[model samples]
Target: MVAIRIEFDDDEQYERLKKLKKHRGLTWKGLLLEGEKRVLEQTPE
Candidate 1:
């Protein structure tokens, strides 16, 4: 129910993420959500 915009510092940063997305065979949403899951799991509330 919300829209989020992601900004990369440079092309290299974006390219690095693109590579991970390709290697994981994940859509952009899946990749971002996976990262969010990891952060939540590692951090205490």
Candidate 2:
């Protein structure tokens, strides 16, 4: 698996993601992967 890094300018947004990850019982990677998959599935081919 490939590793990636991202930065957030908004602390509130980062905090929200952290909360969501905990709420979903997922690691940061899992939450990002799930979000990526959902976005990809919704995008036009």
Candidate 3:
């Protein structure tokens, strides 16, 4: 298992992510894992 640390240096970026988190009804971990899945799906192996 791997752990990731997310640091937002921009206020807008952090707020946007928080808003999306609420809109999608996800906790911090869920938000990150879901985002990871999205990127993985778009990436070519």
Candidate 4:
């Protein structure tokens, strides 16, 4: 598995992701994986 790192310059964006993880009942890692899946599903192979 590959690891990805993302940095946010704005506190609001970071807070939003944290809120989303809480709302979706997922950890940060899980939230990233969920986002990856969603993006990949929409991408053309």
Candidate 5:
């Protein structure tokens, strides 16, 4: 697996994502995996 650093243009967006993770009861790694899953699901096979 590759490590990546994603920067958000707005601090509110970053904070919102943090809140989402907390609300979903997911760790940082889990949040990343969930995001990856969503991306893959949206992509064409």
Candidate 6:
């Protein structure tokens, strides 16, 4: 698997994401892994 780094410039967006992570009780890595899993599930095989 390839790893990529992404940056977000909007402070509001960043804060919202932080809030989501806290609310969901997920670490950054866990949140990203969940996102990847969701994307893969939605894609056609």
- Give, for candidate 3, the lowest lDDT window spanning 10 residues: 1-10
**Model 3: which residue pairs collide?**
none
lDDT of 6 by residue, 11-41 (tens): 9988998899999999888889889999999
How displaced is residue 15 in candidate 5, in Å? Answer: 1.0
List lDDT for all candidates, in order. Answer: 0.97, 0.93, 0.94, 0.92, 0.93, 0.89
Cα TM-score of candidate 1: 0.83
lDDT of 5 at 11: 98
Expressed as tens digits, the lDDT of each residue in 2-45 for candidate 3 is 87788998999999999999999999999988989999999999
Better candidate number, 1 or 5, judged by TM-score:
1
> Which ranges of candidate 3 are over 4 A from the true structure?
1-5
Which candidate ranks first by lDDT, i.e. highest? 1
Candidate 4 per-residue lDDT, tens place, 1-45, comes to 977788997999999988999999998899988989999999999
- What C-alpha lDDT does candidate 3 achieve relative to the native structure? 0.94
Cα lDDT of model 5 by residue, 1-45, tens digit = 988788898999999999999999998789999999999999999
lDDT against true structure, model 4: 0.92
Angstrom error at residue 3, model 6: 9.3
lDDT of 4 at 25: 99
TM-score of each: 0.83, 0.76, 0.76, 0.79, 0.71, 0.80
Residue 28 shift from truth in candidate 2, angstroms: 0.9
Cα deviation of 37, candidate 4, in Å: 0.3
Give candidate 6 regions above 4 Å deviation.
1-5
Clashes of each: 0, 0, 0, 0, 0, 0
> Considering only N, C-alpha and C atoms within 3 Å, which residue pairs clash in candidate 6?
none
